[model samples]
Target: MAWWKLHKRDKPGGPAAGGAVLASAAIITRDQVRSVVGRRQEWQAQGWDFYRTVPELKSGIRWAANGLSRARLYVGRIDPDGSSAPVPVDAQGGDMSPAMVANLLAPLEDLAGGQLGQSEMLRRLSVHLDIPGESYLVGFDDPASGERRWLVCSPSEVTSTGSGGTIRVQLPDSQSARIELSIDDCTLIRLWRPDDEYGYLPDSPLQGLQDPLRELQGLTAHVLATVDSRLKGAGIGLMSDDVTPASPQQSDGPNPIHSDPVTASLIDAASASLKNRDSAAALVPLLLRVPGSVEDKFKWFDFAAQLDEHLLPLRESATKRLAIGLDTPPEALTGMADVNHWTGWLVSDTGITMHIEPKLGLICDALTTQYFRAAWEALGIPDPENWACWYDTSDLKQRPNRAPEAAEAHARGAISDAAYLRELGFSSEDMPDEEEQRRRLLIQLATTNAQLAPAALEALGVQLPDVGQAIATDAVRAPVEISRAEPAIEAPPRNEPPALPIAASAVLDDGWRMACLDLAARRALARAGNWLLSRSGRSRRGELGHVPVHEVHMHVSPDQADLAQMLDGAYRDFHAATPGETDLHAAVDLYVRRLLLTGIAHERGLLAGHLAAAGCDRAAA
Candidate 1:
């Protein structure tokens, strides 16, 4: 939905009173605002966590498209001041090495393919990775002054992409660069290659620029309102003049999976259904990831959405659900006295943003999966099928002498959630029921869930309605096939050796295809003899199977690292010097550069019989 249309708090100016049209998809929840307005409040209070509501789908268009279009960014001395001059993003004679530049461009490549821009784009800079206090410097060649200056990547852009993946941005080229980009799980850690014409080069800065915050130019109010806020609220303090607008050289090119007839039709149908709302632009991309990311971690991208999220809480019983990640620290839940209640939130560096609303139906299965895991472990439930019994509650609660109305919920032969009890099974009649006791029990029918959350609306004192429409309705009939997935079966070892993924030039039909196969063969060679026997091989392609141009790298160094670091820094300079890259395509290019530097692609070629084969021969010798 449009940022203006989403839930807005009543401010002195009114809902979106000062918001400009350029602020289209950008919207923060009242809770997020409450963070800036109420920072020191000490989430020390019970259930006082936070979450930044991300758009269901956001494109990484160049930052300039929005009100921040005029924003000027620069290298820094640090702080909110214009004390530093804008950095020069180019080197006169030194060329960054191609390999290092490839490392830098990995993440940018992903950005281009994914369709992110400006506020929309930067909002996700650190989505998958985090490297606080680290920075990348760019040397710009000032054509007019003939002076070179250096700019440091601000905290806003240097944030992380979770999963240790790259940022995916394209390298700076004079418009005609033929860079095709796509992401594959294996390629994530390898260096990417752009079209042959363009080459990588490296250069270092002679000096650094001043921090933009020091300039504060008419932004004292915003800065103070935002000083303590971390990366999340950083952009808020920025005036339209403060942000470094996205260069169009960045953006994810186009949807490749959307080309599939079934997938394409699904997106088209979904698009046709919601054509009336312009803000629903990202819906298509959100749906496409289910079929994309070969690695399930990529599925987290979908969790970064709003549509399915908003409706999740509503689909289940109002009873609270509790979730505890094995990795979460007890410190995170400091003041939360009641740990049994249902709690969900978006996790990130700034902090956790708790989701207060009920979830929709689509995500119910996912939630059940997460929480039921705890249940399965609690009871001696050997198999998942045994856990299936937990979802049905009728058996424990139903008994003789119960009024017809009492049995109405289960009378239809549905697998009612004996919502009445779980783990510690209990029945009304067995406990010598009384009307008053039953009334109290009626109010909290699902005793099993009591352990799951506060007893009532008044109990925890959460400000939601008590006697209202039932939050979750009766379970519906299954429309689609609901077959349970089989457990992963292990593959038995085989004695046969592996073969390279090869291409008959005629069968390949194109150089790109030939290139992909050649790369695959090279990969096989790299990993040959490293394994025992038979192995499976896979290939990744973008658009019509062409290698995209972009890179992403994650590392912290004083000035530079090795050959790769020098090159990544060089091309990052190239992107800053170039302009007009605020789109999904450019985001991919940027990722590409970083990916190359990180050496994610270069490693993919070492799977079987390729360059990584020496080890097997060594073992035999």
Candidate 2:
């Protein structure tokens, strides 16, 4: 049998012999679990080390780290109804006491591990979280204070039960003493990320990506190996034609036409000399004496080759594949030139929002459940279940490359000016104080009033107070008398109509206007119905007007009143959310477009119904 072929065969229709043999064997064992852990440890170490050398992996991990580094922690309460309320810090003069939330934040800011800062710790954890899809965060309680502190543990240091519900942690000590922890142990933080199936073991983001990553790695190694081999093996091969000695040398017979051995030795020496030459000339020439009358020929060969043109694109494809597997944008991974700056920002923001933040959120949730519950219980707080630990992700919620969007929103009254200012990069401290803001608002209001007063008086045909005379009494601050007398200003020509003043109550709320428009629409619908009924009568030929045998088109054309009513309805529906009255002509034009479409539909429906009835009547006849 061939090496690949099985030595034994089952029945033709039965399972494969090898598969049966494997199925009969035990799948899970203590050694197998340990071996799997060993493999994971190996992969983690290799993956981390590889990140430094691989640009794609480095970019992906750095992107995730930079995105998560912006996280701000906040202590908050999860209500019984699943709503959350932030428990404010007392340092900021919040209602809640500082002691309540400080316990959680303190340990987070100062983890038990090495001298790594909080940002550094998160960056490391984020890398492991993304690459491995799981990480173990071990907590150690203070011996005297009993406060909880955390240390990030390698996956290899932790072992799990068969069901994976319990974990055994090996302390990083000389003896490596181990401790068993239950599934709910607050000291153990297990981050399990499963894509489709739920299990204690999580699938890595690099799982499906390994093939492409390894391919890229292999291509890189091949390039390096080729370069190394080329540099080490680079040299020219020498070729010479065979020559025959004329005769043996007799010392005194004109060197007796050098013998073959003597000539060979001389040629070898000449070749070595040529190789050792270090002259400034571009080419070195060598002359060798031979024992034969035949001319000697020396040929030199070059060492070089044309590289494969397809390798660049193939390597790029592999990089893009790996990036896709990591949920990272190709432009981010490869610095793809085809992607514009705005597009790259959008793509990066999407990856951060949809993939990166959620992973960090999972870590936050685990920490919250473990630390917040314990801290609240230690503080004699009741129903600690309502409280959870969370990070502030408000900065990440902003739309990338859309700072102008905030300004537009402010202009539209969708957001406050303070929020707009913040979006524009002004910190809370940079904003004007409340007192200064109040003074600014007063000045703005006064200026607005001054600007509008002249327009209001002009509309009423009242002239402004003579500012020249008022300036004389400016020192006394006396009010100027209004001029009731009609000014010498000539009225508009008779051909030009005078503008009419609008009433104060001209502006109506949406609901009231919509109701009036609805009433008008209902009346129009009633009139249309009556008109359609009136058309169903005896024709001039004394036959049913709507009979199909007559073959007359039964189309309902809209009248001027009907069209006007529909325009009003469309106008009301379009501006249903408007805060006040709008320009009548503009509103009518906007509504007429929509009214024409709907009116056509309504007429078609009525005509179709009438035609169907007429067809049935004709068929009965």
Candidate 3:
């Protein structure tokens, strides 16, 4: 006989060859298995009850679940050297293509015969995990359709067999048949337990929270009872010794004349009448006839004053305790009245880091091992152990304002362009290419230099090519040229005509002239202060001559046509002489521009006195 046949055949008077063999008898008793299962069932029942009835607990779980369900699911490849974090499977330099990764994740979109989507499935799984401290996801090939289907099973619907890594789920059908699934078909995500020797049963998060939950429920009941008593209690009292006797004609049967029977009948009639009326009856006035009673006749008893003043504080404390027990932020369960925008973001971050992330990690690990790896192998993918399903929580985390920091870092060359954009909550895909970034930088640099004084440009060895036309076309094609040049001092012309007195000009009214001069003086002071601060060792040689002269040009640019027209109307006759300037508009524009620059230099203590003093001296001459 062949060796295989000999191994398969049963030996005479001995155990069968194909049967499972054990070295010794089972050490764990059947009673122990039953005890574990019973304890888990009990915890599950309590968790479901509290989750359904307790508002605080429900709110905490809902916050966590809703936030987690919004996260995106992706496949990431583990780094072999462990030098950095895992990268997405479709990322650059990765072996897998986008099409391949999509194929692997296609089943997640159509789970449970299209009855459940990825988000809904995640929500259900999160809810079950938080409640019972364990959740189940079962996958199997459908016999009729020949396609895989996944189902999220509730804790109450699934039971562990505790022997061979197997579980039984009771289907909710007419037959209620129990289906047995092995480790290959089901994944169980559970909280870590230090006492679980076999690792078959894990503890629930709600295990030690029974006292707080019970206290919350008790406090709620007490509040309801207190309010109920106040609403149904007496509001007023009438005390009198005189009683009115009933006449024989008014009484159809036996009539009582004592105060006790009369008072009882009267109270019953009032209570019945009030009960039949709307809530507005509480505001109505009550009149009672007590003859010969002047002292201590009517007294108001405040039943509402008997309510416990400390009830609200007690309930708030209980709710906070429940939130603490569940490892959630108190603000999430209660209200966000105490939280500001930044603190709210911090709370969300802390909640995800401390509570939600760990739970999601456990779930993703289970899914990767039980389902994703097998599916990838079936698709003939190599090295299945290198890739796993993961979640991206970027959506759940709120991005803070970091524009200033990002800009400073980029200007200092401390980080790359991609890193700076990412700090501002932008992805690398949104970043422009190197050539485009260089073109934009050049354009911005030229524009900024065009606003500087001519002496400043010459001192800095920079030149511009038609900035106005360049900006209008939104393009820069000419290469910038720089060369060394000797500084020359040019004396002011002695016979130049005095600048037209802007304050006394007839072209504009007093208000317009004053406004224009005031605006120019203010702009000059600000520009001179900024320019003086920007001076460095390389540009100090021409510091005195480098005063900015283009304040009016900025207001007259293409984007500021209205301001340009206003300036033209305000300074039509002002003449400040400039080299090679002939047009009246140009002369007036140059005159105003020089006045502003001179004012700026004077304010910085660069010049001896104000521009108005020189203009006045020239006018007197």
Candidate 4:
């Protein structure tokens, strides 16, 4: 039954109402449907034109395309845990190297046997997908080599035949003919989905950006016109009081030259000369004058400033809107004026993460499902479904260097060796296995012991053994015998006078103790400040608040021992100045604690200043 008839039959009044409703229903003609589709196609064509002609839009698209093209492609296996791993090439469980994988997929490097390498192909695909909302790739086996070869087809030149998964592809043959191929041989990657009754075809990102793009184009044209007008000296306008020019007979006023035909002709010539100047005459001045009354007789007006006040802001606003629509940072399309190095890096990272990665993901998934899988099957690779093509975007991301932080964490035992190695950009395969790490550790211990053994034996006054005999003996037994035989002769002590007590000795000043404590405090403060700066530098603007203050205090904790040693030396020198019963060690410990508290407080203030400068407080709110 027709959809309209079914709708009518569901009415409240049964058959009679059904017949009436059917008669009153409005039918959409095939021409109307075609007209809608035609309009959509025309809109898509306009989008392509914008991508080609509009500088801002073109710049944004190319930025995304180039970023995606920088990614390295690979074929790997999908593990059971949803993570991907390198594909093993042999029964011995040896993974295929990148070069070997590239060799296997060498046919895809040049698509359709043309100069289109993988990078160029990916760039074109990204451009097409973003601009027209869809792209097509057709795969075929090379007749000569029986290896897979693919061609990137224009979306406009490919269409679904709506029968048995067949598609009509226009080939660039001598006749410029069209050919029909199964959908299995082609891949269609698209962006947005269709909501109307037209079909399942996806819509371009430009669909919602048409208004902004058109406005940007208009503003650009206006700017160009304004610039051209300025270059032609159109901003300068002349005004005069006379409504009509007087003839030579009426030349009785103070401005008699205005009535003189020769003078008027000379003035016109000078005006024309001043309009456009050649490069050679650009710096030369040409003056025009009329032999008339001064001041109010003639006036000049400049409109360049007025034009800028109205037009430039609109142009900038339109540009920002278009960039937002494209999911790209404005700094990427526009020049990076007023941007710092850190801000520039942030802009690049955001462009890749938010704008380029999604498009790359779509393209990769489509190729893997429709192109790489089939090729694998044709080559009789076992379990083809277990493997897929992927892209590595590590080269595109502007990740900050956190090696210092990683090292600190590793030393603190906060992270595993593997995690630390990964943070330093080492892949899992580049890291050593447990057994290898243990062997290396043992070798390092043995080398250190060997280097120190001679000095240690001399200090102990023990005779050294022959190297060969030592090696022949049991390693454990040799160490035990040497340790048991170690015994160093001691020298007799020289007699000296006993030190005086505090009250019985000459009075010493507090200046020495204060100086030592101050020096130690300054060193501690410097250490704390350096640590704070390093932490702030590594954190993002929003992450400043998340910096662990306690960790920083712990980092400075070692300086407390240095301060205690300084205090102890100062106490020894000044003990004679104090009372006999004074507990100097207790006093020293108290002063050290006070200095530590003050230093920590100073660091906290510095961190707060950094947080303020980064606007983290506002961000948190």
Candidate 5:
């Protein structure tokens, strides 16, 4: 499987015996080399086609043909040097699309006579090359659909015109007369077998392979003969010096088992028992009796092991010769390669490189120059001369085992996500769409920004609402220092006399709590009012209970507590006096400070019990 070159032809370098440096043209001349096929002298009408006569030739041709048939053909462009690129082709007078061309090349429906698809078409060409050494493909433009159609015309149905550069084809329908087509109108693909100019029909590959084919056939016959001789006792013989006639009378004293009927009968019964049952269980011994006056012997005629002596090397040489004639690997023809997995793969890779690529290049180039370019122009494509037909042979090539390597490349960013998926044999369509990916990105960004919102607001001289001291510290800590401004506008003057101030010694412990509660209540009201101003159009947080901070004080009638009524009246009047003082940022700062103080006081077990009973609970506030 290492694809070793078995034999090399001798080079022309030495001088002849007469001291003349003779040059030979046998290998180069078409007539001299073409004589090797011997088809001109071979008998016809024997129904012995070239491919069917040679089994190895059949397999090799079929293998190469199937590989070419599966090739992916597309509308493309090719350079004069034979390099190719993909190009767009219009279908049915529509915009540039491969639909029309691809369908024409690989149709879902058969083209004609059940042989129109790419695979079938290529197969027919392969068979022709094997049998007749030439293939022809005819193309026509369908006027109705404005598309080009092609069919593989059997080589047998086509006969060349002598000295005219044209071929006549027998139509499939017998009612139609034979139609002559110019060589320019059809694509001709053939191997490099030498032939004449008029016919251009190279002899079949089988012609060159005659020596090997005959050798293989002879070996096969010997093998069958050996098997038959071993299986049917054909090689057994009896040696006797004289012929003796059978007598009706038995001998008087003793007789041979063959001469005595009773003795022969008893011996036949014992032989039957030995054969029908186990020899050990039957307890029968095989015996042979001969007359004393005569000598007889039985011998096994093992016709010399000539078959075994020559079978191996002859088979190998024959296969090698066939491979050489067909330009194929011997392993491909014989399937007797002693190679490990790696070596076998190397040989397969070499086959693609050495055999398949070159053959495909020839076939594709012919199709491109003859059919594809003209078809493209008919579809209204500009600059159609540059375009060509291309076949992608990746499917025919054996892919390396590179799953882990592809994964590593993706992880290293050496390949894109889509490319990685393709390498892993997955479709990129299974991944999320662009819009869905963008939405997910936005949500992630918003969540991250929201978590850092407090710091952002603080940097701009704003603050957040405080749930409690512990909760506030857990959520976000306020800046160590902040600039504060005193209230700029004073309350409007009242019509009543001002109350006298109390001395410091007269202030009670609960008085500080009362002041804190009153401050917290006023700030909360200002914050709510500021929120309503900025977010007027949005829905309010009504389900969160929406209780006011100073609900208890406001609900108490003026007749019950003159002090509470006076404080409420004063704050309400001040709030109404300076409506511009209710800034959201200022209200937020005040609310956070009071809420922290209230939480710390409650933690010290001094405010909670009375706060709820006094109707100033934190939840209500």
Candidate 6:
């Protein structure tokens, strides 16, 4: 499978940037932006160009890293336009990939190994918690007092899906069973109550209030392998139903974007204000490198897309308006043909509210004899034009008159209007010109069917003098009785196709693998003694680019002493912390400290230094 990754600056403006920020801050002497534009030709030299906006992440990515510096955030995952596949299960019901199965069964692992309370485990996982009449919220619980606390799900959880809510649990026997969490109010969020006795209570209050990052969101995922292993060990129903990977999609250079509503919203909305001050903060890197008409079009589409992305999501009523209009009249304004081009207009904006209106909006006219001219078809008559009388739609009436060709087709009738075309590179229209009609027909056919090469002259009624088949072909045998013996099989005795070496074979030696390994190691450290993740693997698991959290753990005693906590605490004090806001500057300080610590680990041979350059520890933390 093909994949891609990016090495972002630890912070926006760093030294290696070679004054990248300074160069980008303004149009400078050095052609930084210009160079990207020029490079467009070079890219065209390599592949076809298509206008595109960046896509959104299909799954919520959880990246965590550690070192002398704080970790940063970025998007990961392909499109989840639809959840088409399920976790795979092998015969005997166990998965061939044990590591994956182990990772998913995290909830069960904590229950079995960490020795945490059922309610506490549920809480730590940020899932629902219950112990008879008394109740507790996930994560919101006080560690010292054991009082109920507000809990949040991790970033990687799937908040909603088609088949109501989903839940999967693993018992001590290693078997995992899928269960549907009762969804009382989907508008809010819903989760399974740990106590079955209260599970069915609609008024239980927590019914529809599902936490975004609940560990249970991944609960069904974790025990998948265990379920398979258990089923296999016990001779359960055979399977692989739930385990296929999603197909990959289009990419651009090092960047790969999924095609989804979010991406469409972002890239399409880019047009409204390609140079807007707010978007400049995050878009400079991407925009400076791409240009041409796409940038222009992105602005208009961006306005409509943002309406659905940012504004629409929070205002519940908009969802209703959108659902109703998606397939009908109002949809034309936001539909592909209009939003994609400048064929639409922003009719109203109360400074707060914006209304988009389509040019050739929608078709609503009824056809009639009056809509056509007399002698509309005289066998070899010109195709009828001027269908204006037939349609009564305001959109069609208001459509901008452009594309001379589309307009040319408007009024030409039985009498060719050749007299009207001398200035348009054509002889007079209304002339009984056969060649002109054929050429026009050719263009019409090509536009209607982009495939199929232009029809040969002979095929056209115009008729070529003489031409034969373009290529030769041979017939093949067919029709065989099922009872007849199969064709005799023969084996090749010696000759075989020559082997070819991959274009690039040093990929494994490169630091990408190590970067991924370090990512996994840091995650393992974060969840140490936690159930989900399996026991440590061979040296392979802790290979290059890996700043294993295990290194820090080795220095800790029985207690889980996180170096990330220490660095976070130090930065938190240095920078002011609001009650709940994510401190941006503090994040920078933490990443810097993390880098130093990780760099030190590499020097001491306790961790791999090569991974430090790639920010593996930071990404996973």
What are the models' TM-scores? Answer: 0.13, 0.50, 0.58, 0.51, 0.48, 0.12
Local accuracy of candidate 4 as per-residue lDDT tens digits, 1-621: 311123223234646655332211111122222322212467778998888778888888888788877876666666668754444332114465655555346424434443335777778787877777666565544446756445566667666565655666676564577676543333333323243555456566787899999898887887777665444333322334433332234346776545455456434433443575443222322223344454655654443333667677788788888877785666776567777866666777877877787777777676666555544544445676777666777677766677999999999999988778767877657877887786666554433343333444444454544642243222212222221123111112224322222322222223454344334434444454344445454444245454443224323333432333232233343444443412222233232333343322322223222223322232112
After superposition of all CA atoms, the RMSD between model 1 and the true structure is 43.4
Give the lowest summed-lDDT range of ten residues in model 5.
Answer: 1-10
How much lDDT does each candidate structure score? 0.25, 0.49, 0.53, 0.52, 0.46, 0.26
**Superior candidate under TM-score, 4 versus 6:** 4
Residue 255 accuracy (lDDT) in model 2: 43
lDDT of 1 by residue, 372-407 (tens): 222333222234222211111122122333345445
Whichever of 1 and 6 has more TM-score, that candidate is 1
* lDDT per residue (tens digit) for residues 522-556 in model 5: 55444433433333333432422263433222221
Model 5, C-alpha of 182: deviation from truth (Å): 10
Which one wins by TM-score: 3 or 6? 3
Q: Which ranges in model 2 have alpha carbons more than 4 Å from their true place?
A: 1-49, 77-117, 141-149, 156-186, 195-198, 237-298, 303-306, 394-405, 408-413, 427-433, 436-476, 479-621
Of the candidates shown, which would achieve the greatest TM-score relative to the real structure? 3
Model 1 poorest ten-residue lDDT run: 201-210
Q: What is residue 208's positional error in candidate 3, in angstroms?
A: 1.5
For candidate 3, the 10 contiguous residues with the lowest summed lDDT are 475-484
lDDT comparing candidate 6 with the true structure: 0.26
Q: How many clashes in each structure? A: 192, 0, 0, 0, 0, 71
By TM-score, the candidates rank as 3, 4, 2, 5, 1, 6
Give candidate 6's error at residue 384 in angstroms.
97
> Model 2: which residue pairs collide?
none
RMSD of each: 43.4, 23.6, 12.9, 20.7, 21.1, 46.8
| Tens-place lDDT digits, model 6, residues 69-94 | 11111111212452422222221144
